[model samples]
Target: MSHAPQAILARPALLFLVLVMASACASRPGTDTLIPFGATVPGAKLVKLLVATNRSGHEGHSAGSASTRGELRFEELTVSIPPQHQPGEIEWSKTTVRDPLESFVVVERQPMNATDFQERLNSRSNGAGSTGIFVHGYNYNYTESVFRLAQLAADSGSLDVPILFSWPSDGAVAGYVADRDAATYARDDLVTLLETVGSAQTRRRRLLVAHSLGGWLVMEALRQLRLKGRDHTISKFEVALAAPDIDVDVFRKQLEVVGKLNPPLAVLVSTDDRALGVSRRLAGGRQRVGAVDISDPALREAAAKADVRIIDISSVTAADGARHNRFVQFVALQATTVVQADAVTSLQKAGAFVFNAAGNVVSSPFDLASRALSSQ
Candidate 1:
């Protein structure tokens, strides 16, 4: 890789930064810190969203006995703060990123029940009638999950409501198996949320975004929806799976079934996903679907049949060395001013395209970045 002056200065830092940013092993051997929720950045917009979780919100990554939908909390977040480049850190301040390499600052939070949430959604959504549901993956706590959702909503500039569905995750590498079980156990809760949102309003757009292991949860939930003949509930949804840690073969089978909702299922995949490399080993040599290149004739065929649009972001880079997922960061395509700002909406508006010579199904990164920044 040719190193520009900036690349020489930035690349090595990111090599270390990616390890510090995504690895659960860096901080205290096995403990996950519970950053106090509700910290806010002054002068930033307060993002209000519905949170659904199966974990005991009291902290310590505990899961209550009641696995049914567990609890719903209303959250208001502040995204004006700077990015916490280090892992396990939360910073809420009035600072904005001129560097454009920043994380979402979740300033404040409020916990409320489903009844109250429904009432508020009914009243608030009356104006725009849109909602974005974010399903978090492995090793994420309630705070990180909600904050990530708030950030995406803020950057997207398109979502009216950002909903977070956080399942029980101990946030420890050793808890991977436990997290999988918890995600399976909580499938019903996601189904419940899907039904509620589906029937919430007759006219609206719903976007379901699931990352890493959460992608498995979403696929399972959708499969169950199909089994129960309730797939219609997802009529308004446009689902996107990013860096899904599902077995590639298993995912193909899933697409064979979930393809019933074609055009509705879009996948954002990166070929060089480092985190999934670990998962691929743990799964007994099975390749995780998210890490597979869609260019392979068989894989490409599978995607085509499922009508599953694959946004091959293999060349996509992030300040964090393009390690795990690239869903939240501003997508610049390159270091140039091409895709300068608010990339979430651009990808959404770009919708789903076909695989190109490079096997990427999204718009040319250059075109995408330019269009995105120009809009702002």
Candidate 2:
């Protein structure tokens, strides 16, 4: 009677059955879960969305607000704007998503006046530190953009002053043209946000971080700001474009125009971005302006002329994937935090504008890698 062998064989089947049952039980969705918003911490100010335009402008209005001091909760679900523009509810439920899938959750959902938003940006680091405004790329919803911003902020650790500006994105690959149109339509709103923040006497130093088509929006907004700023006592704002979907010639011209305002700018690019790669293919198979690896002599010459700082980020990565989405990618966030901290430090000490190969302006000597290298 070899009962021990039977028991050992039976144990494996028992374990497998237990595991299957456990997974099945866990797969059941929750019927009721309320996602909380606004102030996980006391006295924290929530971000106010200034403009919200979906398929129908104003006809489908949605707004909510929350501060940096909060734990934004989500129940693995999507928030949809009803046709009648009803006050949408946040319900909790279990969601089964494949790996590499993206999800979005709203921590705070309120739109505010332009002036109030400016005041909050200035107060983050006593007007002495650097401020960051992140403009997300294409294929992103408002909810997704906000959470991505949150993830970037959390990962950055040092970016105490961060702002997320979510535009009305179509959130589909086929909607690239549509998103571009929407971005153009929303340009004025973007400009207003920048101008308000730029006019802040408290925090004079700021940097813009834009990805994919968001880069075009940032550049356009900056170009507008520079046009306005040049006539008055307006100082230029620093900017960084990560994986922009802009034509090289157009981007170059943008730099030439904005360079007059003397704001520091950086372009972060990667070679492995599939979306940008496909876009380049569709645009006649030429290497993208944002691809820093191609060694375009014209672009290099332009960078030399415009003094742009082109940081090749193709080699960087995070746990999720390659740091293609700079904002959400942890390593990219670290690099970004360094840049911001350096900018703040420079502002604290009053630094001058320094340019790089890709028409970027490093405003402070303290913030320049070259300077650090020289010192080392």
Candidate 3:
């Protein structure tokens, strides 16, 4: 019959969907704009980061899919943030000529061997407060992940040594399945990086932050560590997953293996995360952990029982339309402000809380009673 006419009409709809997805992922600058301009600009802040990755190409500037061998590489970079930069924003160069005063610019890049990398990390770790390791989500190139970590450190005014663990995301909107596979492939390398960080002979704390698909990789790595009886290494860090893209059932199973830590794991979730909504649909209608409704009594009870702190960040406005990056805004606010003890204590417990628009933490009466009971 005449099904050809129906197929012809559907092409435009598919094209429109492709364009929307491209626009959403193309808002940030790509690796072509990552050329280093050695000159420094006055009034600009410099952020230094240690980066580890499993992607092929030069150590200083590698991206795309993982290397066939899946070997680890290391590099250090210094990025200059413009003085006029706002909190929770990475200002890309508007013109071809990168401007350090108006946008982010790479000032220095150095490649390091494994021994040198570990020694450098140890030097930074000795008695220097906490170290922060950031694992970026899907659709991120090497340059974007590097700059975003630099921006986050500068915006939050954090004193922790910043480290970036860049997995092999091809950085394409249409490469979701490929990126997920790459994330799974990079699990061992992530574990190796964690072991190196944990081996440092110091008493400083460590914070591991993963977003979206990176959350899945992190959970798998932690499960591996638990199976290997590396509890001491796991004890050195606190973990936070923001807008994680793992299926609800999968996350529960992973939690069963990963078990609980000294400070409970923090999961930053938003009900209206459009990116996760798409992921949920792609996963055969299975709910993504990051988009779960925290107000649901059953979900809250499960989270509490698992010693997980689920913080609903739906009240915080996202810089992007997708609402997937609200965690960046939340971190900026939490880092800049001196949160009160009650709010801090509530967050430390296993329950649900809300991050209000005013950058304050709100706890429920049930959580308060739980805290009180735990204190006794």
Candidate 4:
């Protein structure tokens, strides 16, 4: 998700200015100060939108807010003016030098509902439009999630739609259980966020990018959402799970559910993710959901037999030597540009690729592939 440096600079400046204005307008904490939605800020073409997590929680080192006392909840919302860049400005990355493996950012954070989400979608759905919701893995703090997402959004350069849903993560190797439990507790919030943003009213092209434990939460949420609705609501949604930390069998079941909902969605798996491999060892050596082993002969048979798409991204090695963080580290790969272009193209075309048992690129439903593939 590439953006003109000038445009990127303009967004933060505007955000800084808005924060200042909002601070001046509302003297009390937690008061909803409405910033007009769907408006364009100076130097921006697309409307800048944002979803503020008013669900009370501790902001960094600050005293715990009431919202942070229990399961995180989304209470308030707002839509910011659009940034100068188009929707193509959003991106995702696999960080190697960085501690956090992956990240994403939307040029404009919008209100957290189906309606506001739709408005943002309509604004970006023209030529190179897309809508992507990123669910990050465990061991991440809020800042880590936002900044990485911001970079990804910038790198992907897809301006259609960029969203990052950050659950409470302690950013510690030992905090895996705590983070998983927290994500489970927040499952409903995730579902609500997805349904609200991906609903018919919104009608925007949507994708879910999940990593590690976040992958589990994403699959579980989608499974539960489909179970509640009986598979009618998930067909329109797409998913990309990277290095997920889930039991292999659980992942298989989830895949069966997803295949029934949508044709083999993109599942990026890696064999070199050290942390996840350790998790596999802890899980009695059973393969994990997002591991490269998912593409192994036996597993691939299962995947293909179930009509699921498992893309083995293991060839895209981590340049940073950071194991278990392929999503962020793989950004260093030569395919970065291709993947970025494919991202917007996939969104605009509303079709994605499927891999055979051998990990070969099969046929796709992408529209205007030549034009969309060219990084003009």
Candidate 5:
């Protein structure tokens, strides 16, 4: 008799218990801290974002518990990043009153109709600059997602327009199942956002970046577009998935439907991602795409055939303990134009590559083989 089935069943149960205990010991910020302070400080940088959400509003703030009448809503937000801000960190205030000089604060907010949102996006993209739409992962509230995009935009200094595609996440460690369902429920709405951006008359490039479960949502929306014979819409954007928590087989199936994108899809992966490690166990011990060993010839061959670029970032230290947020650090490193230029030059082709701790890109297989032979 095989114990593999029993082992697989026990792993998820064990992981759940461990996660519950960890959650109990974790310190979380108060939801009231999410409120906008509406203040500005000298030497602070401002990041303006076009926000679209399916989250329901409560007391003038988007609540994490409900959807917006089963439809998408649009808004514009301006976030103030403190002068003392550090890369790869979202500095939250310890007190209810946020200090603009020390913490990230929202200074301006404007509710917009769909028409106004598209028009504003069009105007921003009328020049040669690109638009970036970020989809936040699980365990994120509306304000958290908004500020995260703001941080990325402020740090990278690349995006002409940053848009946040905020889905309803319960924002609790124990609410993982609910967040998964919410991500699935928001798929059609995501397609709408993609279509809205793709239909613009402007010729500017579009970049869609999704993290963790948001990667699943983005793939599903792209698949939906493909099924509807709207491949052109999918081709309009460059895609990237960071620390995606998708099962490997499921990702393969998704890629089969997504087909070959013009610029291909860039997948930022880390073998040491503890969050994806937990996800893999919960998924019947199936491997997750984000945690796959990129140096494996099989994975490299598959990625090449599918027009995907696998970027292994295991060498970079993560700001978070789980090591699932190295992408933030990666973008922060790109803030230095020299590193940005070099990294882009190295990643122009579709295959596996390693982003080292020193902000250099090396061919993954070559790097690993050389290290192995040297050790031998």
Candidate 6:
């Protein structure tokens, strides 16, 4: 009789073990393959982005980062829009999702080039006549860059045609030197991309956004464009460099040339940035342009001469580990609000407050943290 009671007790223990194992398996996603964050909201489709990359794609994974700079190619992918998502990681629920960076799943993907992209762009009704190009920085693989551009586009909802210009970055912090050379080699290719876009059947609002080292590429490309007397061929929109990693002295010369284009060039810099500090050290004690305070006498004149407006976001709280790309966070947060498109002018109209060269002070700064994190 005692043996019978012991056996009965063991049955429940076995059942508990099975339940625990089931839960563990359920926790993991269906596929081991990385997917982009969040499922689409009910009755919604995917957010598509067109891509142009100079990185070699014949590697093991077609979407993997290019090992060497290759011929520039065009492709497109679509990302699902997760309803009620905040910037960065999310909780698992109907209203939220798991971290976006964990996996990069896409609803649809296609092979395309500049001509096909233009056709699709012409067909789009939302924010027509606006083409935004995003240049990624160091330490980004190809997949990561594409998904991020998708996230930025979906979140901003301002871009009519979202284009990702991904150069060959070694995708490692230690690979800075290699990335620099790679970016140099890709400079002319960037010009070609720009010219192709410029020659599109329709003229549109051309916006360029470069982050970190990619900002260096933008300056170089613009300088080249100006040198070739080709900068005027394409209509330009507002240019924003978020935590640019360009050398201070070099950036000044770049500003001298690009400023002639005279579309508002906004340098979104933060003094609290730690990544720029490392980049500064790498540049032999020279501070990167993004780390330069707007009040710094050196850059203030350049800003004034170039008609560049300094939006000092050093006061904004950073959720990402590195305080470098605060511009992306700001865009993501703005999407949460009922703000509509035309985001270039939205910065001033949103009453977010801008700081002049008075040492980059935010006049009447409001708490954007709580607002950014609020349940959407």
lDDT of 2 by residue, 124-144 (tens): 547444556678877665545
TM-scores of all predicted structures: 0.71, 0.62, 0.88, 0.63, 0.87, 0.74
**Candidate 2: regions farther than 4 A off:** 1-110, 119-127, 229-234, 260-263, 294-298, 318-323, 330-376
Per-residue lDDT, model 4, residue 177, is 58
Ten contiguous residues minimizing lDDT sum, candidate 6:
363-372
The residue ranges of model 6 lying beyond 4 angstroms of the native Cα positions read: 1-45, 58-62, 88-104, 125-129, 336-376
Task: Quote the positional error of residue 357 for candidate 4 in Å.
Answer: 19
Candidate 6 achieves a global lDDT of 0.62
TM-score of predicted structure 3: 0.88
When sorted by lDDT, best at the front, the candidate numbers are: 3, 5, 6, 1, 4, 2
Top-TM-score structure, candidate number? 3
Worst 10 residues of 1 by lDDT: 27-36
**Over all chains combined, what TM-score does candidate 2 have?**
0.62
Where does model 4 exceed 4 Å of error? 1-55, 58-128, 200-203, 257-259, 319-321, 329-376
> What do the candidate models score in CA lDDT, each in turn?
0.59, 0.48, 0.77, 0.51, 0.77, 0.62
Per residue, candidate 1 scores C-alpha lDDT tens digits across 1-376 of 7655445335443344345455533432111222333454344455677776766544333321222234534443334434433322323222322221343443444556677667766666665435778898877666567656665655555567777888877665445667888898889988988887777753445678888899999999888887788868866576778778899788878766665452336677777777677677656679887778766877766666566656766555443443675654422222222332334343434333333323332332212322333344
- Could you tell me the lDDT of residue 112 within candidate 6? 72
Question: In model 3, how many backbone clashes occur?
Answer: 0
User: How large is the C-alpha RMSD of every model relative to the true structure?
Assistant: 9.8, 15.0, 5.0, 13.2, 6.7, 13.8
Lowest summed lDDT window (length 10), candidate 4: 96-105
Clashing pairs in model 3?
none
Error of 5 at 186 (Å): 0.5
Least lDDT summed over 10 consecutive residues: which range in candidate 2? 66-75
In each prediction, how many residue pairs overlap at the backbone (N, C-alpha, C within less than 3 A)?
A: 6, 22, 0, 45, 0, 6
Report the Cα lDDT for residue 347, model 5. Answer: 65
